[model samples]
Target: MTTPGARAEAGTTRFTVRSPRAEAVWLCLFAGEAETRHAMERSGSDWTITLPGDLSGTLYGYRAAGPWAPEEGCWFDPAKLLVDPYAVELDRRFVQSPLLATFGEDTGGIVPRAVVPAPLAPLPPEQPRFARGGLVYELNVRGFTMLHPDVPEALRGTVAALAHPAVLAHLSRLNVTAVELMPIVAWVDERHLPPLGLVNSWGYNPVAMMALDPGLCPGGVAELRRTVEALHAAGIGVVLDLVFNHSGESDVHGGILSLRGLDDAMYARAPEPDGRLINDTGCGNTLDFANPAVRRLAIDTMRHFVTHCGVDGFRFDLAPILARGPGFDPAAPIFAEIGADPLLADRVLIAEPWDIGPGGYQLGAFPPNWLEWNDRFRDDVRRFWKGDGSIGVLATRLAGSTDIFGPQRVGEGCRSINFIAAHDGFTLADMVAYAERHNWANGENNRDGHGENFSWNNGVEGPSNDAAIIAARRRDLKALLGTLFASAGTIMLTAGDEFGRTQQGNNNAYCQDNAIGWVDWNARDLALEEHVIALSAARAGNLRTFAQFPDPVVWQSRDGKAMTVEDWERPGADWLRCSAPGTGFGFTIDRAERSVNIDS
Candidate 1:
């Protein structure tokens, strides 16, 4: 239980924190532009101290002095220096300041300090190189190596430019089992994006929760443990995506940083003169995983990224506000304390489930050993390739959604992570070229992203020097990367959507940190990245029948018999198929010949 910030040891260096209504909490430190503070000692909802020698790379933070009463949540600003929700490292980045929401406003030069972190050792507990139906990808470590031309303009956009060997040969030519990233922690920049000069380039507005974002991980947890040991020596796997449902100290007029000045009941409020904090992650607040000290700072920030940066699991962001004790509990005691944590039981978790609160659309309601971000398989595979859906909802999202993850977990192999385009919408070349949401450079005039993006435009909407509308947007992006590699499960793709990367139609470029959030890598589309590396070598040669829902099944139509429930509700039926033939696997699709034809 002794795990809250600082640590160090062998020459003294303890620190701790967890305020539980601070009436005092000091420990400030710093030394460069000199500071000091000390005075901790609470022990009962922690405060501790120890100090003497080994203050490893020292630069600490935290101040706390209780009750300023953020309407009842209590933000106690000892002139706000806070940051250290077990901050694994942060000595900069987290700018936005009205002196971090003013009040006594010293802000120690506007926040960001917590560095201490020098104890290394730990990475032995193996098993999590990520496999579960392979191919996850996602990305955004500074928009995937900020326009990487083999990443070395001083390691272009950080996380050590994803262990670059041209980013591990483009994630080993997309046979990537798990990259996911998207929020290399330490975020901030969302107080309406610095009054629209804009900035949160998608680190999803975090703030410490296990640091690592000295501007996209500047060699921190040993540069993410040497890029997870060089993506486990190129067999891929990192994961992350994090945002434990909100922090970046946002809501009640935001900012006293780090768990909102060390515990505004670590967010999640409402009820009682409308105490008001729970925004359920439209990112304004919400992070009281029913507070067992916010699930022990989310299981010690997932065991400091699996014992100091091995990291092979966690996607979470707005994941039904971690089974909301404020409402949505598919038996959430933080999912049995992360399935009784042994460094998070076999890791891989994933979720992004849903959360504008209330029933918060919990797709398949998490915990069947997690993994779910199937925005109903991205709006029924973009409304069945934008021809207005149904070939029975694209054969229930090409066989695995099983009506929102049921039918015995889609015949025993599905938690459904399928994707039609992510990192929050539109690219797969702007969902076949932007039917809407251009975002007016996100000043919020085109009212920010996703306005029903079961998108379309194929005839010519955004960029087109018109070679037949860029060959019908690369033939609807090779029929949406051949219906996300003939569906089934754990799919995902996002990072430059296999070589097309266009935020030009800005599906909320998350405050476009320049070049509309990087990744141009010389205008990619090497024939749609060799058709997503031949659909990741045909889903790695049918990885266990694309990880489930393939077995003696048939489902045909277009005259090869079988299919009828009136050919999955006829209306211009388009065409269908689906074969399994005891795992030779299948596909076919057509949608009036925009084609997809996979067949293992």
Candidate 2:
């Protein structure tokens, strides 16, 4: 196979590919009304082809002829057209199409031919100014305003909706200082979803770390810039949830996406003991940060976000995986460099400090200046207030979890990111409404979500007209919010938790891209929204109360009893009065007031 008049030159428009294992490869191009098949030339393990003019907006795929063997991770069937991992533009949105197949031998033999367009436009200027001590609301873009009737139908799913007056009004009223939009980077549905008639809603499986998903940015970079500027004008910051721990491309058996094609050796492969790919992320393959080239790629991606997207911060998904080598170490070179980098050092760096890898739990081990998602705080507070445990764990968590975070690195004066629920799991409403996970919609039976929810259904599995259960659920929600705000650390709230959004007991609603996960603006409970607003107001009114440095909060129980270590361990002591010595305010709570007291 050979491409006629194909040559490599500085200004020449030609693409090259090489697969020693393939007998032939063809470049299939959608040129006007007809499909043109051009044979590609092979050089060693590479193949080459060239187009006469710009191929912008032209649909293209590749065909490679080779044997198919399912067991050994080689499924090369040239009959299927492969998407280019580095294609800057996509011709179609990802619909549930079986026509898109993953099984192909010589998968790397084909590439999505790059579409030539006018010279790429320069990115928007960065907005570096951000308000200090701002409350950040973590939300899924599609879930935040997608179902709201107030948002224009065309703008609902795109970045344009974020700037709509209705959306801005909601954020302004809630007094959110920042809106940490979940991963909006270009991503793909997990391979299992299309076959199951499901779609990826979380955007965690990113294919391109630098580019925003076109589907979400219909108006492109200009629209995203407007949204960011709108947020900034309203005194709010914008943070992005980034997933550099791995790519959408799974193991060798997965699709041939970006990183896998640019350089596979840069990724972490199973060690010499097995020589397979390490599956630390549970999503199939773990990125090999051990390789310098991979490290550079990750750093470059971060630079792109900071330099181009104007993001004020980044919340790293599966951050612990980024610090792992043959063993887990908090002081890994990659993390240390990031902390020292002038561009990223001062930016808000939050880590989801655990992965499925060995010794993956590094809860409080992240370096100074880095905030970690306090899962321990989330679990303990839930259990204690829900009447399941001694208050000892809650006491430790409220003080920033010195036990798990270790007194050495994260003393009583460090800031921890505390939250009860995030986008990955159940909403606050479902936490108290279901004991068992109802993830049947995910097509993996009921095994797709975590089995141990540490949740109590309050005597009902889901929605109920019973007054007692409803009241208890509401109180619990308030309590959870209160506890998060009162804790001696930074607090974060899931977007719809304030108004009581429920996934109907589904803890893992990652693939339900519809109403199950979206916020219902029409059905929002005004009273509850007010309660959440009041909580935010209280926090804003008394920032000193939650601050950790300078002095620790001193408390005394109502019966003239000091809150000793033993008092925390005691299971029967429900009503206790706590006082912040330095801040002049004291509050008391039995089990019922825990919701409002802590949140407010």
Score every model by TM-score: 0.36, 0.84
Residues 478-568 of candidate 1: C-alpha lDDT, one tens digit per residue: 8878888888777988887788889888887888889977888898879879878988888887776777876558888878999878778
Over 4 Å off, model 2 = 1-89, 94-134, 406-413, 544-550, 592-595, 598-600
**What does each candidate score in C-alpha RMSD?**
20.8, 5.0
lDDT of each: 0.81, 0.70
381-437 per-residue lDDT for model 2 (tens digits) = 777777785666666777667776655232334557888888877888888888888
The lowest-lDDT stretch of 10 consecutive residues in candidate 1 is: 403-412
Highest lDDT among the candidates is held by which one?
Answer: 1
